[model samples]
Target chain A: MQELMGLYTKKEVYKRFDEMNLMELLTNSLKVQMKHIHIENNQTLLSVNDNKKVYFILKGIVAAQKDDELLYFRGKNHFIGLESILFNEESELTMTSIGRVEVIEFSKAEIVEFLMGLQEGWLYCYLISKDLNHLLVRNYFNFQAKPYERSKIMLNDLAKEFGESSDEHVLLPKKFTLAILTNYLGISYVTMRKILETLRNENFIVRSDKQKEICIHTKLF
Target chain B: MQELMGLYTKKEVYKRFDEMNLMELLTNSLKVQMKHIHIENNQTLLSVNDNKKVYFILKGIVAAQKDDELLYFRGKNHFIGLESILFNEESELTMTSIGRVEVIEFSKAEIVEFLMGLQEGWLYCYLISKDLNHLLVRNYFNFQAKPYERSKIMLNDLAKEFGESSDEHVLLPKKFTLAILTNYLGISYVTMRKILETLRNENFIVRSDKQKEICIHTKLF
Candidate 1:
């Protein structure tokens, strides 16, 4: 129990889980199982037809994609695949590990049991509902805006969220290519490329050669 | 208590509320104080800046609008002013009663106490989250489609969900004006009017003089 508590504390969701009385359920139905898997660049971690499994990222980053377009990235302390289980629907997006990774998996049955047993299962549902709604709202806003406006807003929001103060750069993995950016922003590839080029020329983004990744330039902020 | 129970039973939300143990909370915290007020056509039921009070519609229909665009309509057995109370933010939309109406009101403080004391407070939050998320998702889908496509899809969905079976003509509220339809479909008025004309010419919809509202002229199913 102590070891489990320590492991959970290391994961930030533990605090929220405890507040929602999820910890007790987890303790009752929790099983800790770990597996190490090597995923080559772009290898899929989850697929549309795959059985729903909760994943805790132990190492490396995983990106969610739909039709080769990156939805978002999940890294340490973040989880994915809860949506399918909650809605009893097949996975709508694919998850691919960017590199070799280790993760712990929880089955849908276990999760359902835990949720059913919790005194505050609705809190979990509420949190998930809010997240899904926020995602939908973001998508709606992106779709309603023109390509240029969408790109500007996306970059601005990313910069605000993940940009470092010292460097004024937001570091995102190289796995998030132009295709992914276009899909996430609900824009076309050509438009995304043109916007990127324009931003780069205007000193809003700086590209690094070694990493083959781009960062928002300080002026963009 | 008897009067409150009668009102609760009349509202369909009570069924779900009871399943989640919310009825006990409401019955314990609330007393039935009936008030009669009349809303002239298109008059505001709850304005954007009005104090956050929970209102249950006893009669008539109320429509929600934001930025002068109609979003949705609520008839009997529905609660209003929840968004503001839940988020502690000002109402982003104006709610207007379509006709003369009556409603039961409870202050935010009273409602908050009722929720806080319940085991199902989290469930209430979850339900609200789900409702908001569904609305956002619908808006996203509306944005994703082209103007004409969006109108078609929305009309189809409304027909599926709310269309009534009839011998002569299928009836829907005339309140669904071009502006409201366009806003719900996330399209421009020009586009919506074009689609409506197309549907009208094709006999997919029939305008009635008696009700003077929109009705399905053809069996879409």
Candidate 2:
């Protein structure tokens, strides 16, 4: 995967195959195929134990969960259903759409056949890039930290990445709900709520009704 | 990387290149090289900020650290120094040998050039397999669990995976030092020590002098 990085970006790798018009050439000669799928917001794309299907996300965010627990989220350019494909086991996590999601769906047999047809090494590059991206995000948090410390770090990161900033404060977007934010921090809802309450008491954060938007006080930091 | 899984194991992928005698064919014709190195235990293989070099572990374990904190351990068949190669940034973690180690070292330029010569997808498959293996081990623990709960779960998992079992107890290997075990659990040393003390007092675990090997009392579970 590291070697692939010095060669091409994931998108570029995918395009190299398309640019060759290998799709038309292969489909006409070989029988490899992919299907386009459109999923609505909150729709479950794949449930636990689902197998042999891999979704290449073209648009929108996908939430991965283990039963009731939210594991993480993947957005554009990420592939869902990899666990089942990689481990040759049942899907351990269920994946659902955050908004409307469009994907190119490939069955296990078709993907293997497609790679065989290419023999060009680009598909392998694309897969490694996707896995590297997944690892980067999952490795961002310090799992050893206490809940309060973890929450603070997560909030600071969110503010820097997604918040709208001014001199006094940075406003977190409405999309990052309490559930999503808390889960992303790998903390319980109650713990995160208490942490947020403490931050508010300390004049560090200002929250809107229903806790949709949060204003992180910058001066305090 | 998930896609690569249904294709070949990392070792199998590597062997595909060698078995083809592509090395002799290419080195004689195109000029590419890989170096083999032996590292002694506790010796630093790569320091923070070192770039462009990747190590393919042929034997023994390598410990990755961020300063004094143990980040994770990678053993045989894993690649060390991928972060620098993938991100095009300085290495974030320092890698050191845990035991006498053997590795095939490849410079970034040499590796990329070699892959280009092969025109085969096996190298890409190998890279993805490595990343997938890394992600699997890192994702094993529930980061949100309390330290006590986390330690218990980790201990149970360790016993199942690496411990020597008897009717009454399970003995953790001598290689699992307090530092290594606590760090792998992603808990503070003090917290892990306190947890162990409680377990011992409750007759759930027995420890030898200097805490070399821990015997988990099976009947308690």
Candidate 3:
């Protein structure tokens, strides 16, 4: 895998609004009808066919899955169920809290009205759309890869999206478990364990003490 | 595949602007600098990493490819290279005309300015974004499917998007040749031929008389 081609969805253009002080805009928009939601560990945030609301993550991680297959993970500043609003369709992925998750929630109508009030609001929708497009492109190539390469690509994406990087390695958050990895790869627990075991023996990955979090070696990318 | 779950990206919400008379609005926005471009069959419309303009297809079809891999196809009313405008990144796919194609083109700057001028313009961007989001969701599941299932889903999607349906069959446009189908499956020519032969024997698919087009039996979906 190419380091520069690492699947980091956010680009410089996505952060363009930061210079314009998005916090102020978000603060103003907060006056609209919205809710502060707190979900317990393992709680469901959104389910397939639910399309009434959107949630912007404030803290902790959320895992998105379709049926039993894990699709991906999202963290702080990511919007959950935005696809419901964008496509005006039922939520395709079932999102759940990995740990305790905090989010600011908005009804579809409220958010749509708020977005209509701003000239640059389309840019926000455009940015989220770009994120999905990037994933599509990544997965397009990923599906064609062999098992080891597919596992490596998924881990590399996770490391880039949610890991804390150091000179030697990238440390994934504690909430990312082996079970979640297995789910993402859509393989049996035993099969995924063997794959991980092989990768570990080769020094491509390391699990921290207590097996809570995984450390991905930088050279894997 | 469930008939309702047939991968049609456009929904009732996407058609909302149609009732609002988008043509008049587009005509009004036509004052902005735009070009009418016509390209012959097999001509390149947008190359990978060249991101400057957006094209709205007025006639014929386009095939989007990443390197040598076929990503998907787009037809009339679809916009090409919009990802460049949305993400402000270099184009990821090389778009080529499948046949003699006509499109209305806009520079990145002009379209941005035009979209900013209307309050409802964000909805336009939102709709296009929704189209992409739909494709992402579709591809997410598609990547995990087996080869035959993947091929069926692609044909079903193409049937719905660009085909003319009768009571018994969905006739795809002439531009969708065997080569394109083979490219889409990412299989060797021999393998794709075998798959087609099997599907044909099973009465799931039928090639047109001239073999320039394909007809999908409605029962396949």
Candidate 4:
């Protein structure tokens, strides 16, 4: 529970509720059941076959995948498995832990009941819809852009979001393999590998000896 | 008011409200003020420069456009200028009337007040959010598919939604011109025209010169 508080605080999840006047409703609706689980570097936390449940990442990193390809990574404070829960459908994408991770799970029945009881549940739903819409639009634009251009845009977004000012770089787990990059860019795996190699040789990114993680070398370029 | 009744039978709107479970709330929220305006073909109904107000199409066809390129043709029961109204932002798209049109306008202030007053307003908001998300996904998928393939998908959706069982044809207004189709498919104007011609020659669709409309030749092949 203490660890859960730290992760949620870092993620600003409850702050977001206050911004939308949904803190009370969300708190009352959610009964936090915390769990600790050890996941291998590439093991799935949740998959298409799993039942719908909302998961809040308490620690470590989890990457979303589709068709055996990595799509995106969610770190502490982020929530995943929302689409399946919202539509009451099977998960369309898989969530895999890039490293050992912990998460809090909320059942769909409790969520539905919570929403029904809340005065601001409708507002929360509307906000989620808006966020999903934005994601789709961003994906569309990314798909339309050239492969290298798309990669650059994604890297820039990540740099801005997760980059530490002192380091000017961010470490991404090896779980974000070439297959994941290709799936996200909607390009061929071969092309993605070639591009990664080119970027590495140019010093735009540095891959460790283990080749399981990457560090952006901002000053090199 | 009587003519307005013809545009959307109170029964039809009520049916939609029931499906959404907003019957009582919608009825209480809406303050009906009907207006009639003669709109010449291809004349602007709402421009990108216009003030933010949501309008419900009561009669005739209205086309939404961006940068002079037609995007969508909306008919009865469809709402326009909603994006601007909801976001309190300037219109990002222009809306034009394809023919003589009648609509009911609701100011954003009034609508917001009404929404806040209703207990189920959040439900309506959630539904709208869900709808916007769906539209974004549809647009993303459309852009991913080939131009011709995109047209086929659009035709199939239209047929399924509006086709007459006996005739096996779906009639669409001239407002759905080539420019609109191109915008919807996110393809070039020349490509959209070429695909339209190909479909026409292949007898996949038939154009009515007298009525100035297109009819699907059959269900999806």
Candidate 5:
């Protein structure tokens, strides 16, 4: 993590920061107001602080959510709390560091002011404006199918994202516990288990010990 | 909708158009590229023409997303396809004009150019950059609850937003059919119905004709 920090100026907010100038302005704004923070592995990112400000991950990994029905993982160059700041509401997500980590924190007031001012980082302001507008629009879609189709699509997405090619099939990343999968998909554990079991029986997924992760071979939908 | 348009200018992106120079630059770029497009109510915003681009709504209403659990409504000043444009992915949501609508449309190439050439519209370019960063960060931590709790919270949110103020507690808006509610909550119709029935029996909600809509007299959760 320290090595990664040494690789560049602290003003670079993301790996692709140079890909666009708007990104540079955004990081610069955050840099001007940011408070450096650190947390131990498995510690809640907000464990010590309860003020609900946004944090930018300068280094290390974090896992967030169990509310949307699955655990989502994030790492370097990512940020937290735009939703709350954009909407003027509290963040609906909680985060825990995957390891010892470093971050730059910003008060909600500062971030909003930065956007409201729309001066130096106005480009970023436009994007987030577009994003919040999109988010409000997206909240209406992403789940129009029957649970069967919905869960199947999610499985496919997961497979593409986290599945590794193996001799027999694709192996899922280790952390997808049945509890997390069921919750993320918004299905009861029993129901999701039964669904997966049926898929296994049909040879869409490989039957294996529940203690281990899942591997998939075919479309279960 | 026309009344709402009369309340604002064509250049204001959010209510804060005049707030920053970057917003001005961002809007200027879009303004130069924007083509005035109109669609009648229920008309396809993109059902026929399939090139995906971000559109800023200037008048009337539109509802986007066909595959998600519920219908999302957008009105004048709202925009669509930002998620797709920013992420460089196909928009999974479908859209239709709600009544009659007018929009400012910009092609993907133009928007991308606008973002990349930050030296020109540095302000807008900056805003989108920040928004994407915020979005990537936000995806990690929006949920941290059991599925049951999460769904209930969504219900409370719906009631709070759409429910009307009547003497008999707040009545839900007319649009929340069980179909919409069940889909929005991502619960099976039978399960959601049973859950609501149980709430009714417990006096958290009033028994009502399922044919029309649902109303709540107490905390439904």
Candidate 6:
């Protein structure tokens, strides 16, 4: 521990760890112990049966797929690889970086060991539970929502995670095109465009600029 | 523990601890710790926000609902109250007895302490994960499938869970009516009847009797 601390302290690193989205779930000690890793764009960060590592995204996007099926379009602030780690089974899912990404890695053994420290470490369980709730509920809504409903749900999800609240409306985090929105909803671009047209007509959403930022006007679901 | 064991020894009051569902996931000591309860028809077995007990169904059917939405129509050999207990959050979903139901219940604290034992108790996590996977995937399939596809997917689900295998064909566990099938898939009975007619014409499924024991003629999916 001393050697690692010394190695990090020589202007190489120090205790003022940068605040991270998902890492806030960890205690300060656990925070410093987590190792950082970078994955290149389009790289296969984790593949089928490679379950030794578990991490949380600190920046950028990663897509989780099982065979040809897309499981999640995971992004920063999400606990990636959590499902597999919880069970100790080698993952059958493949995770690939959509772009250059940063993540904080934790060894599978260390995580289990930490979780096992039960009463003293119950927060870990709560943190994992929180992630499970979000991921599973989002997936459920995806299964239940119609194209128009899906558009609203996805927009709300994006806004909740990345957007800014204003006096009149909530603004989207970034410019999103028909293609991107359609992909998120697992629908066709034409259908998504039509849905957006309907939403605009109904005043559920409005395009903020040429850059495509969206302002949500009404709760559709 | 000894007193409880003696109390049960006067009569043979247990299954041979058969190779049934949730029991396989429990440690032996925990298995002995479970207490049995019977729920009457139309009874509220576990209401929303009641997170005190976790149970495994031994017989009969239970319906889990979140207000007007049906979450699951659970039958025997399934663990109930799993999600809430894993998160230690009170369940918002209400579980009601569809018929006379038998269950083996365990105290929440005991289960958590048992799980805190780790390695030996990790099976509980796996059990929970398997359930989560089933539910999330089912919800996803629900979102993706059309009425016809949803019907087929649901039938496949029933067959996988309750069907009996024979060389000639797979036999459904129970005689299900068009109403029941339609309700499970969230479609109209008329549409479901039409789907069944088409299935019979295509030889994908054949009804065994007026009671409606469906036989799978081919790989439907």
Top candidate (lDDT): 3
Question: Which has the better lDDT: candidate 1, or candidate 6?
Answer: 6
User: Which 10 successive residues of model 3 chain A have the least lDDT summed?
Assistant: A1-10
Q: How many backbone overlaps does candidate 3 show?
A: 0
- Show model 1 residue runs off by greater than 4 Å: A1-52, A57-76, A81-103, A115-121, A158-166, A197-214, A218-221, B1-51, B57-76, B81-102, B115-121, B159-165, B168-172, B200-214
Q: Provide all candidates' interface root-mean-square deviations.
A: 10.0, 6.3, 10.9, 11.5, 12.9, 11.1
Please give the CA lDDT of all the candidate structures.
0.58, 0.63, 0.69, 0.57, 0.54, 0.60
Candidate 2: deviation at residue A188, Å?
3.2
Worst 10 residues of 4 chain A by lDDT: A1-10
- The TM-score between candidate 5 and the true structure equals 0.56
Give the per-residue lDDT of model 4 (tens digit) for A96-118: 77657776666654565565454
Candidate 5 accuracy as lDDT: 0.54
User: What C-alpha RMSD does candidate 1 show over the true interface residues after superposing them?
Assistant: 10.0
Clash list (residue pairs), candidate 6: A143-B143
Model 2 residue B220 CA deviation (Å) reads 11
Candidate 3 lDDT, B94-136, residue by residue in tens: 8998879998876765665566566455566656666666676
Per-candidate TM equals 0.68, 0.68, 0.79, 0.67, 0.56, 0.73
Which stretches of candidate 2 lie above 4 Å from their native place? A1-42, A56-60, A82-91, A99-116, A119-140, A156-175, A198-210, A215-221, B1-41, B56-60, B82-91, B99-140, B156-176, B198-210, B215-221
lDDT value for candidate 4?
Answer: 0.57
Over the stretch A4-61, how does candidate 1's per-residue lDDT look in tens digits? 2244442454356432344334535436333344556767767877755666565667
Model 2 per-residue lDDT tens digits across residues B1-221: 33444587746645654423433443364455678899887888888556567777777778766655565566666566644333434555678887688987767556555555554534443444445444543343355566787677668766755578899899876667787877767777888889998888877787657565689988755
Candidates' RMSD to native: 7.8, 6.3, 7.2, 8.5, 9.7, 9.5
- RMSD score of candidate 1 (Å): 7.8
User: Model 2 compared with the native: what TM-score?
Assistant: 0.68
Candidate 5, residue A185: CA error in Å?
3.4
The fraction of reference interface contacts (C-alpha pairs within 8 A across chains A and B) present in each candidate is: 0.51, 0.13, 0.38, 0.43, 0.17, 0.17
**Alpha carbon deviation, residue A31, candidate 5 (Å):** 8.2
Residue A117 accuracy (lDDT) in model 2: 53
Best by DockQ: 1
